[model samples]
Target: MMRQRILVVDDEPQIQRFLRPALDAAGFDVETAATAAEAKRLAATRAPDLIVLDLGLPDGDGKTVIETVRAFSSVPIIVLSARDQEIEKIAALDLGADDYVEKPFGIGELLARIRVALRHAEPAGPLPGPEAFGPVVLDRDRRTVTRDDRLIHLTPKEYDLFVLLADNAGRVVTHGTALQRLWGPAHKDDAQYLRVLVGQLRAKLGGEAASLIINEAGVGYRLVTS
Candidate 1:
């Protein structure tokens, strides 16, 4: 089997040196680029399965690399940057990054995030029936949610919110994306509405099942399958 390729875009030699062998040992064919220009060029020409990008690039902002690559491919991009500001994370995510890792990160955590992104990028097979996470089952065809065989009633908006999180289980769904999808573009900035809706949904899900909806704080929420 061909090893999955990872494009590592970072200006710091330390980071490159740190990740190359670790990623290689983890079974990825690794490629490195130090500037935005190089990153974009390699991304287009190399067709890597995934990319680990830094926000601060010598030639330009890393987010632009995300925009440029996203224009042509749906390949997963993970932002590995020192910037931990919420706005920076939101911007990277909204710009199409599959995941974000703050700098000084542990290799183990980064590897886990990479695996999740790759799994999500894989083409999904058609669902055989209702999707179950823990005791909660979401029947998309019937538009119903149930917990331990008992029906759990949800409002239309709440159902939509739940479904969105469920669809991207184990991945953080940014607030901007969620708002824009659940509400219209006009209401995309309305975070309070999302908070209220989540609270309501959590109440309905109840007990340990409600805990499945994990909050990403300033980012958004992720539905934990495990």
Candidate 2:
């Protein structure tokens, strides 16, 4: 099989130097861009399988790169930034990034996230049956959730929230995206509403199964399928 191509967009030479060989060693075909303009050009023409982007670009903010790329492609884009502010993360994610990795990050963690993004980008196959996370099983066709063969009831909003997380299992679902999907664009910044819905859903899932919903502080939630 051909190695998956990763477009690394960062203005810092050291970051390029650090990630090029690392991503190559990790079995990816790596390409680098040092400015937002070049990043957008390469993204449009190169057909990279994934993109590792830095928010601080010499020509423009990385978020614009995300917005531009997202306009035409669903290829996974993972933000690699030094900015740790919650707003920065939310903006990147809401703009269509698949994942965000803070600067001074571990190579192992970054690699793991890259793998998850690649996996998520792959074409999904038909589900054989109800999707299970730990002891909780969600039967989307039947619109029911069950834990250990016992029925677990959920309100409409709670069910929608769970479905969103479950569909994006193993990846962070940003607060903005979740709220907008569940409550429309007007409530996109209403993280508290998401929190309450999550709590209610977790309570219904109950016991060890409740742990399936993993919280990414200041970011969003991830559903642990395994």
Candidate 3:
């Protein structure tokens, strides 16, 4: 497979300076743009697998760029900005940004999210039929969850989490991974939200099924292997 390319667009030369070399050293085809016009120009020729976009572009609003990009592609977009307002985050996510991140973030977390988006953003084959993990059985295609045939209702995010956890039944999944898979980029550090959601999932799954989802303290969560 070709080394995945990422277009990192930000007006801040400092960000590009720091990120470009890092991404290149890490083996991605890195393209940098300081303005939305320049970004659109590059994007026209090369639709990257993922976009690490900054909202504060010089030429135009980043939201417009997002709209323009979504017009032609469903490429995964992870918004990077200093804005921390809920309204700002909601508007971006509602407008089709897969995720958003505030400034002053650790690059490792960003990379983890990027990996997840690249892994799951593409099209896929048919899902599994009835599948068992611990005491819960899920039919992925039908979106049905049951504990020994008792029905369970999961929110969209919860179901997505369930599927990912089920797919990697025995592996430890970092809280960041779960947030990336479910809430996208912006919520990775919001581990508390995930904690509550996981707690709710455990309650719904009942005691036995609940035990399968284990917390790993400050790291992440894991699914106990049967």
Candidate 4:
């Protein structure tokens, strides 16, 4: 089997030393870059399956590097950083990172996150049963969604969220879990977006049918079943 490639970009030599052996042992082809510039160059050539980045880089901040790479790539990125601020994490996730770990993280947890990030990134066919509830109806296989027998417009993110939830309808999807899976680990605390999104979804489907996607207090949201 071909080894999965993982890019590790950090200014700290210690990070490369600690992460390389661990990743190699896990059967990944490890590539190391000491600066953001090098990371970008390596990413362009190697197209690594995942990236481990430190927020503080020698050439530039990790945010810039992330933006640079994300301009064209949807590659999974896990940010390793010393900063533990909630806003920082949310910003990174919102910008398109796959996950994040605070400094002094466990190798085991990092490995676990990598597996999850990759698992969720895998291609998925549309779910079965023709996604529908109340006024919304989506034929996954046909790539069609309708409201009251008329097509409804959806932005990519909105459609992504709808498909994810519709795929597992009538089940409770925790806010933290959904945000992490869809947006990234950094967005675990951005529950406010959930409310905003749900409201918009309700509006798009018409106010009368808004209850199809129910909110679970103190936990998360779920599709209304009963």
Candidate maximizing TM-score: 1
TM per model? 0.93, 0.91, 0.66, 0.61
User: Between the candidate structures 1 and 2, which one is better when assessed by TM-score?
Assistant: 1
lDDT of 2 by residue, 1-226 (tens): 9999999999999999999999999999999999999999999999999999999998889999999999999999999999999989988988899888898999999998999888888897776379888898899889899999999888888888888998788889998889989999999888889998899888888889889999999999999868
List clash counts for every candidate, in order: 0, 0, 0, 0
What candidate 4 gets wrong by more than 4 Å, as runs, is: 126-226
Worst 10 residues of 3 by lDDT: 167-176
lDDT of 1 by residue, 1-226 (tens): 9999999999999999999999999999999999999999999999999999999998999999999999999999999999989999999999999888899999999999899889888897876389899999999889999999999989999999999998778778998899999998998999998999999999999999989999898899989977
Q: Which candidate order results from sorting by TM-score in descending order?
A: 1, 2, 3, 4
For candidate 3, write residues 119-140 as lDDT tens digits: 6576776775798877788897
- After superposition, the stretches of candidate 2 with alpha carbons farther than 4 Å from their true spots are 124-128
Instruction: Please report, in order, the local distance difference test score of every candidate based on alpha carbons.
Output: 0.93, 0.91, 0.79, 0.78
In the predicted model 2, the residue pairs found to clash are: none
Residue 44 C-alpha lDDT in model 1: 96
Error of 3 at 93 (Å): 0.8
